[model samples]
Target chain A: MLDYSALRTVAAVIQTGSFEKAAGLLNVTPSAVSQRVKLIEERLGIVLIVRGSPCTATETGEWLCRHLENVGMLEEELLKQLPTLAAPDEARQRVTLHIATNADSLATWFLTAVANFTKQSHHLVNVAIDDEDHTAEWLQRGRVLAAVTSLEKPIQGCRHLSLGALRYRATASPDFMARHFPDGVTADALVSAPSLLFNQKDRLQARWIRQIIGRELAGPVHWLPSTQSFVDASLAGMGWGMNPELLVGEHLKAGRLVELRTQTPLDIPLYWQMNRLAADRLADLTREVVQTARLLLRHEGR
Target chain B: MLDYSALRTVAAVIQTGSFEKAAGLLNVTPSAVSQRVKLIEERLGIVLIVRGSPCTATETGEWLCRHLENVGMLEEELLKQLPTLAAPDEARQRVTLHIATNADSLATWFLTAVANFTKQSHHLVNVAIDDEDHTAEWLQRGRVLAAVTSLEKPIQGCRHLSLGALRYRATASPDFMARHFPDGVTADALVSAPSLLFNQKDRLQARWIRQIIGRELAGPVHWLPSTQSFVDASLAGMGWGMNPELLVGEHLKAGRLVELRTQTPLDIPLYWQMNRLAADRLADLTREVVQTARLLLRHEGR
Candidate 1:
C-alpha cells in the first residue's frame, strides 16, 4: 500500500517548490520533508524530483501526483457526506486543481469556465500555460489532470470532449496594413512584414499562412509570449499577427484593427481531455467548460 | 575561430525547434543541418540542443545564443554600412533578440518599450516571461541577452539600470470586497477570504500581506497565470489580487474595482540588465526602454 502522508508531503514539496516552504505549510522540519521524500524514492526505486532552486516533478512524480489528485477527490466527496471531519479553516478543506490550457483561450474564454467553476465548487485551480498543440503532452506526461488542447485523439487514461474550434484571423492595424500590404496581402509582401508569434511552439501563423497562401513562407517575426501583449503589439503596428477572433471582435467591429484578407481566418479545433479517474469528480468543471465553449467558440454552421 | 555557419545553424534549430523546419528556413537538407550541429557539438565537447519533440536549449546552448545575439548586432550595423552584401529577402537581414521580463511588466509597459524600439530599428524581439525576482537568473544562466528584473545589485557581466517601481494595489470588484470582507478588513477576515496568486513564484501577495498585516496568515488562493485574465478574474469577483496600478487605474477610477484598504500598496523596484557586449550596438533599444520606463513607471516622490 502507498503511504498517503508521505505522498502528501511529496505533493507539498512540488506545490511549494521547496522543502522549506512545504515544511512550513505542513508544520514539519525541512529535513523531515526531505527525509520522507527520500524514503519514498528509495522504496519506489525511482527518482521523483529534480531538486533545484525550484523543485519540479519528474515523470514518476507526475504519476504519483495524479494518483494523489484522484485520492483528494475521493476524500473531498467524503468530507461533503460527513461534514464533522472537515477542518474549520476553509483553506484546509479546499483542494487546488492542476490544469493546463493555451494562453489565447485563457485570455479569451477559459477563465469564464474556471471562474464559474470556482464560484460554485469548493476547489481552486492552478492553470499552467502552453501552446495549444503542446498541452496534450502535459496530459500525456501526467503533469496536469486535464487540459484544453488542439489534439483530437484521447490519451490512454483520459476522456475526451470536443470543445469546438477557436477561430483566428491575421489582424493588423490599418496603419500597418497600409505600410506593409500596400500592394495587397500577398505571399511576396508577407515575406517582408513582421508577424507576432506566441513562441516557437506556436504554428498558428504558419498554419494560417499555408492555409490561405497555399505554401510555407518565412517572414521576419517578433516573439511576444504574452497573449494580451501580442494583441497590443498588433494594435500598435509593431507586427501583423494571428489574433483569436474572440479577442479581436470588438476591435474588428470598431475598425481599430483589420484582417489581412477578407476570407483568411483559420480555425483550430479545441478539445477538453481529462484523466478518467477524476472525470466523474470533475463533471461540474467539464460542464462549465463545455457550456462556456458552446457560448463563446465557433460552432459548425453557426 | 568559431564557425559562424554552424553557430547560425544552432540558432536556427533553437528558433524553429526542429531540424527539418530549420533546414527549410535555411534552404538546406535536414540531414546536412543535423550533421553540422552534431559536428559542432563534438568539437565543443558540450551538448547544445536537448533533442526532443520540440527541441530546447541546454545551458551551454543558451550561452552560444547569447554570443550570437551580440554578433547579430554587429552584423546589422555592417548591413547598414554596406547594403550590397545583404540577402534579397528582408527576413534574412532581421535578427530575433531574446530578452526576459516579468508578465506584469510585459502586460503594462514592456511592450511599449519594445514597440517603440522596433519601429525605428529593423531588428525583432523575442521576450521570455519569468517572475521579476527571478528574471535576472535568465541573464546569469546565459539564456537571454538582457532582462527586466527586480534585483537592485548588478549582475556579474551585465549593465544594470533602474527602470523605476511597478506599483501594485490589492484590488477587487465591489461585490467581491463586500462578500469577502463583511466585517471590515482584518486578519480574521483575510484568513477566510480567497486571494489571487499568479503562481507559486509570485511572492507579491504574501510580501504585501507581511507589509500590511505584519504576520503570516494562510488563505485560499486561485492561481490565474495570465496577466490580463488575472485582472479579469478580479473584475469577476473571483478574488482579491495584487493588480498593477497601470492596469487597474481606469477600473479603479470608473468604480469597476476598488482597493482592499486605503493605504496598502506594494511598489516593486524594476531594473533593466543587459549583456555589456551588446550594450553599445543595442543603445537604441536601451534608450527607448529607459525613456518609456521614465514616462510610465513611478519614481521616488512621484
Candidate 2:
C-alpha cells in the first residue's frame, strides 16, 4: 500500500504550488515536506514535482494524484454508508473533483449539468477549460479524472460515451455581410474578409471555411478568446466566426445577425471520457453530462 | 536593418503552429520557411520558436513579436495617411494586438471599452486572461503589449495609468445565509461553510474572511473559474464568494443575495501598463480602457 499521508503531501504541494505552503497547510515543517517528496521519488524512481516557485507535478505525480482521487471517492462512499465515521467537522471532507471541458460548452449547457449535480451531492469541482479537441489530453495526462472531448474512442484505461455534437453557424452582423460579401461569399472575397478566431487551438472557423469554400485561405482574423465576447465581436461587425447556435439563436431570429450560408451548419461531435477506475464512483457526474448533452447537443450529425 | 521577411515568417509559424502551415500562408516552400527561421535564429543567436506540433515563442521570440506589433501600427498609420498606397486586398493587413486583463474586468467593463474601440479602429486584439495581480508579468515578459494590472507602479519601460479599484462584496444567496449563518456570521460558522473560489490565484475570499472575522481557517472550497459562473454558483447556494459589485448589484438590490458582512468591502486597484514603444501608437486603446474603467470601477478604495 502507498503511504496515504505522503501522497496527500504530494497533492498539497501541487495544489498550493509550493513546499512551504503545503507544509503550512499540513502543519509540518518545509523540510518534512521535502523529505517525504524525496523519499517518494526514490521509492518510485521518478521525479514527481518539478522544483519551482510555483511547483508543478510531473506525469508520474499526476498519476499519483489520480490515485488519490480514486481513494477520495472510496472514502466518500464509505462515509456515506457509515455516517458514524464522519468527523463533526465533516465539511472538510468535501473532495474537489477536477474535470476538463471546452469553454463553449461551459457557456452553453455544461454549467447547468454540474450545477444540478453540486446541488444534491457533497462534491465540489475544479473546472479546467481547454479546446474541444485537446481536453482529452488533460485526461490522458492524469491531470483530470474526466473530460468533455472530441474523441469518440476512449483513451487507454478510460470509459467513453457519446455526448452528441455541438452545432455551429458561421455568422456575422448584417452590415458586415453586406460590406464584405456584397458580391456574395466568393473565394476572393473570403480571402480579404476578416474572421474571428478563438485561438490557435480553435479550428471551428477554419473547418467551416473549408467545408463551405472547399479550400484554405489565409483570412485576416481577430483572436478574441471569450465565447460571449466572440458573439459580441461578430455582432459589432468586427469579423465573421463560427458562433454556437445556442449563443446566437436570439440574435439570428431577431435578424441582428445573419448566417454566411443557409442550411449548412458545422456539427462537431463530442464525447465524455472518464478514467475507468473513477467511472462508477463518479456516476452522477457522467449521468449529468450525458443527459444534459443529449438534451442540448445535436444528435443528428447533419 | 533587421530582416522583416524573416520576422513575418516567425510570426506566421507561431500563429499557425507549424512550418508547413506557415509556409502555406506565406506562399513559400516548407524548406524556404525553415531556412528563414534558421537564418534569423542563427543571426540573433537565440531560439525564437520552440519546435513543437504547435510551435510556441520563447521570451525572446515574444519580444520580437512585440517589435512586429509596433511596425504594424506604424504601417497602419502610414496607409491611413496615404490611402492610395493600400492594396485593394488590404484586409490581410489587419494586425492582431495582444493585451492581458483580469477575468472580472473583462466580464464587467473592459469589453465595453474595447468594444467601442473596435467600432472605429482597424486593429483587432488577442486578449490574454490572468489574475489582476499577475497580469503585469505578461507585459514584463513581452507576451502582451498592455495589461490591466493591480500593480500601481508601472513595469519598467512601460506607461502606467490608474484605473480605479474594482469593489467586491462578500456575499451569499438568501438560502445560504439562512442555512450557514442563521445566528449571524461568525468565525466558527464560517469554518464549516463551503466557499467558492475563482482559482488558486484568487485571494479575495480569503482576504475578505481575514478582514471580517480576523483569522485564517481551512474552509472547504469550490473552484469555479468563470466570472459569470461564480455568481451563478453563489445564487444556487453552492457557496459564498466575493463577487464584483458590478456583477451582483442587481442581486443585492433585489435582496436575492446578502452581504456576508455589511459595510466592509474589498477594493482592488487596477492600472493600465503598456510597452513604451507601442504606447504612443496605440493611444486610442489606452484612452478607451482608462475612460471605461474610470466610469465603472470604484473611485474611492473603500
Model 1 vs truth, CA RMSD: 2.9
Query: Global lDDT of each model?
Result: 0.88, 0.85
Error of 1 at B286 (Å): 1.2
What lDDT does candidate 1 reach at residue A204?
88
What CAPRI class is candidate 1? medium
Q: TM-score of each model's B chain?
A: 0.90, 0.87
Clash counts for the predictions, in order: 0, 0
Off by over 4 Å in 2: A1-3, A13-66, A78-92, B18-20, B29-55, B58-63, B74-92
**What digit string (tens of lDDT, one per residue) describes model 2 on residues B132-210?**
9789989998888899999898789999898899999999999899988998888778867878888767777767877
lDDT of 2 by residue, A87-199 (tens): 55432556879999998888888888887787777787889889998999999988888999998877999999988899899999999999899988888888778888888
Candidate 2's TM-score: 0.88
C-alpha lDDT of candidate 1 relative to the true structure: 0.88
lDDT per residue as tens, model 1, B1-302: 99878988998898878898788778899999999999999999999999986788898887888788777777777777888884565336577788899999999999999998998988888899999989999899877888999999999999989999999999999998898888777887887788888887888887787887886555778888878998999988888999999999999999899999876889999999998877777788899999999999999999
**Residue ranges of candidate 1 with Cα displaced over 4 Å:** A13-24, A27-66, A81-91, B38-59, B78-92
